[model samples]
Target: MSSTQHTDTLKNVRTISTLLYWVCAIAIIFQILVVPLVWYAPGWVEASTSQMTVSLADLHALSGWQKYVTMAVMMIPSLVLAYGLYRLRKMFGAFAHNAIFQPEPIRHLKAFGIALLAQTLIKPLTGAATSVLATFHRPAGERVLSIGLSNAEASTLFLGGLIIVIAWVLGEAARIDDENRSFV
Candidate 1:
């Protein structure tokens, strides 16, 4: 492409990246704050948790304290997700400043990938913990300690690995470019 066209494309990338950065920021906030609030509502909780593989019977069995503890436990995955979003935001911020091949953006991408991989593990654990907590008050035989993995988790694992590989490739390319420039 011509120099002017390349410059224009980079400028467009910067604008889009800036917009994505803000969107990620908003998503982080929503994940941290709004999601937990939604859990407090019975209808919302039932609607959301109904899709879970592990049966969560008698969610009402949880006392206020138990519910709070469960909510906190559930926040573990949300916090992980927030961390991933933060890394993504940082990556986008770097891109917005036209730092496409810089180490900072690549680092952020790798971090985000790690966070995604963590979510695959942490999410199932948290779900099990939440289930146990929710059913703790139940009779001994009825108590739940269920652990399950869904397609979503598998997809996350795959996507995370892919992103890490992409980041590695980008890092290598940057290194080669830098070396080539030094030899010129």
Candidate 2:
């Protein structure tokens, strides 16, 4: 192939690379801003005669701006992810109807892997954050966000690393396949 062809292919790959980074970054940022609020917001539980138990549902019943704001934040992760995935899939180059990658309907499958981490962390973060705010003045026992992250949060790093490795393998396979085709 001519130098121009090689340059064009490299340019296409570069665009895909930029897309991968942007999608993942947006997912992480959106999760960061939203999940903590949901996890930490107040809830309701029955109280004993001697002691009191706050119902977690009490937070759900909150009215006016509090309810609306919390709901909006909670939905941010899903909305941002859907939009980013749409863009990333477009950039990744879709599989044809009969392509080996099947489901020409999908894109950014690997990049959306970040959403899995978001699922595991956001709940706990929101719960801890809500508790901290509600009891801001109290003794602050066992601050979930402060003392240490949950086991799930810690595992997410490993999952993200694994996703990266899988992406590398896919890239290497594509490169090898391209090189072999050139000789044919």
Candidate 3:
């Protein structure tokens, strides 16, 4: 590529990276703050839980402190996802500064990958916990403890593994580039 073309491409990358960084930041904020508040709205709760295939009857039965606790339990995966987004924001920030192949970006990429895997693993447990919390008000035989794994979780696991491998490759490339620079 011509020097001008390369420079323009990097400029475009920087602009996109900056946009992604802000998007990640906003997403994290929304997950952490706005989501729990929105959960209190019955319509929103019903819509979201129904989409997840969770029993609306169990959810509707929750009240008072049970609702708060159930909401907290359901937020676990989102919190983990927010942490991953934070790492992604850091990586994008480095890219925005033209530090794409640096250790900082690689580190953030690896951390983000780990966070994704962690969230995948945590999701099922949290789902079960949330179900139990939602139905805990019921009598002993009626309380629910449900565990589920879906294609989405499998896809997340695969994506997380791919990202970790990519981060490893980038780290090796950065190391080689540093070694080559040392000879100059």
Candidate 4:
């Protein structure tokens, strides 16, 4: 592509990077506030107490420690997502600087992909952990444990795989570009 194309592409990437930066910042802040929100404003959460159906009120009604445990359970995936978003923001930043073929963006892409895959793998664990934690104070007969798979998890894994493949392709392209330069 020509220099003008590079400049235009970089400009678009910069715009997208700016948007992603704000989104990640806001998401991080929201994730951090989840505990406080759950503690102070339980209305924001929707959970039921039937073990099969738990509402935010059910979680809110738990003892303080139990609530904290539940919060921790919920925070794990959110934190991972935040970290992924942060990596993606960095990747976009590099792209904005016309660093598409450099190692930095490739590394960021790989990290983000791994992070997403990690989240996909841990989702069931988190759910089980949360269920166990939520029932920490419950009577023996009232306790419950559950785990399952969902389309969202499958989608996440697919996206992660796609990202890793894209990174690999880019890396190969960078190698080819270097080889072509040698011939010049």
Give the number of the best model, judged by lDDT.
3
Worst 10 residues of 4 by lDDT: 46-55
Q: After best superposition, candidate 1 residue 119: deviation in angstroms?
A: 0.7
- The regions of model 4 sitting more than 4 angstroms off are 1-6, 47-53
**For candidate 3, lDDT tens digit of each residue in 1-184?**
9999999999999999999999999999986874465455546555455324257556666789988787787788889889999999999999999998899999999999999999999989888888788778888898777888888889999999999999999999999999999999
Model 3 ranges with Cα > 4 A deviation? 45-47, 50-57
lDDT of 4 by residue, 1-184 (tens): 9999977887887788777767767776785776567568755553522222234555667787787778788678768877887788788778766677898888889888988999778767877877777776778888767675778789989999999899888888888998999999
Give me candidate 1's TM-score against the actual structure: 0.90
Q: Clashing pairs in model 3? A: none
lDDT string for model 1 (29-136, tens) is: 988984456555545556666545344445545668897898788788789989999999999999999899999999999999999999788888887887788888
Model 1 lowest lDDT segment of ten: 51-60
Query: Which residue ranges in model 1 land beyond 4 Å of their true spot?
Result: 45-47, 51-57
Q: What is the C-alpha RMSD of each candidate to the true structure, in Å?
A: 2.0, 11.5, 2.0, 3.1
Error of 4 at 31 (Å): 3.5
lDDT (0 to 1) per candidate: 0.84, 0.48, 0.85, 0.75
Clash statistics: count for each candidate: 0, 14, 0, 7
